[model samples]
Target: MTSPDQPNPEAVSDETLFGADVADYARYRPGLPDAAIHLLAATQHGVPDPVLLDLGTGTGQVPRALLPVLRRLVHIDLVDVHQHMLEAARAALEPVRGSCTVSAFTGEAHTFTPAMPGLAPTLITSCRSFHWMSRPRVLAMADRVAAPHAVVAIMGDGSLWTHEADWTATLRRLIQTYLGDDRRAGTRGTYAGPGRPYEDDLADSAFSDVSEHCFPVARAWTPEDVLGYLRTTSFARPALFADRYREFEAEALGLLKAHARGGVLKEDAEFTVLLARRPGGAA
Candidate 1:
């Protein structure tokens, strides 16, 4: 499901749509569950020093979370269209990358080529950013770069705007009052849902053998935390509100405070990962 904050796939460039919020995103966006990383690493069990290709690797959250666990992971190719996001990801991964070599590529995911020779990825990951890409094209490109047993993992969870909670409803209503009924993605237009399921797209791609996994996550947010998270999202980005941005913040803070129990808000969400591989492979 598309949220008010999710960018319209047709409206703008990836950098313009997401780069403006890079700092906030790096600070507030949730990391992948440890169990999910374990599941991803388990797929590459016997492979010695496997390579990882992470598409749409915003701030390198997936790599940062997976590097500590996947001792066999030897190299990582972080691909993104935004230079700032690529730099942020490189910085985040460098300090912790013990035996692994991390490299960043500033370009669209579908067209990215690995910088290192003979680098066929054993595991390819896209977290919370696959929706921005052309699935078939990316899968075709992956086919050219992936090893025989490579697994393509697509993972995401709903955003704060899509979460069902009393405080969220109230906050959404306030946004609607100011931004109108339509969910404003940027200055250009509103969001349109991806018409079909991602599974359907993957089913039609080269990576047709698919398996799914889900992790239940419980989160606690302070009023300040919620505000900080909003700053990272497309719907409530400060630049989108312009002159009324501070006004919206004041009212939103008041609403959050009214609903908070000891300045804390609670949410229950499910993080899902879909792992796909070529038919007859051991993904």
Candidate 2:
């Protein structure tokens, strides 16, 4: 039975959930030095080597990218709602084992409580993962869980293909050429994309005494890379489709190849990062 307030699990599977596509997400995905890095730079003025907490850390990209830059950070707590996503993050961070200590766990954002002793962190960040959380619940958790000077940065509401024209038309044309117009309700629109707007509830609220900014990042994707990425999308899964899977795949590849620059499709993706600091704790 579906509850009025809760997400419909039957309508969505964890494999197809927000945590999916984490493997190729960091590899083929563009827009690094994303909102999280910007937030770290802003609050890093006086803080040296402060403990870091990464919420909704998919494939450990944010921490892995930011680890080299922090002056004095020793440990990172990577939290996620899905165990599999955390596992992927663990694997990605293994090559850089000596850089920083990492503790990964699976738990709901609302009920999550750090078990680490004396673990009040100086920085807490979420990259492209904040939208799944309920705003009020997350705010309450932030208020209680963070150290006084903790910085919370949530990045989302950014688009991967940000062409000025109706890119949706291009996307639809590609999908139709492959799938032949037989679309599932879940896979029909922009909602099926890997990116989404963050926290519709907090859409109206602005952070006080916190600086928020958006940075533009671009990446060039070959036909193969784009296909690999699209395959990671929720709609591209086997279970999600009733038929025409390979036909769709081939067509998608062919369509993008037609428009690819130098036989590559360059996607313009943008990420919105939210950086907020608690009053008085650590620098």
Best by lDDT: 1
Model 1, residue 11: displacement in angstroms?
15
lDDT of 1 by residue, 196-255 (tens): 888998999889999999999988899888898888776777877889999999999999
| Per-model lDDT | 0.83, 0.60
Candidate 2 lDDT tens digits, 142-173: 66777766777777644323344333357556
Per-residue error for 206 in candidate 1, Å, reads 0.8
Regions of candidate 2 where Cα sits further than 4 Å from its true position: 1-13, 18-22, 34-39, 97-99, 160-168, 176-207, 279-283
Which stretches in model 1 have alpha-carbon errors above 4 Å?
Answer: 1-15
Model 2 / residue 273 / CA error / Å: 1.8
Model 2 TM-score is: 0.77
Q: What would you estimate as the lDDT of candidate 1?
A: 0.83
> Candidate 1, residue 255: CA error in Å?
0.8
Note the residue pairs that clash in candidate 2.
49-72, 49-73
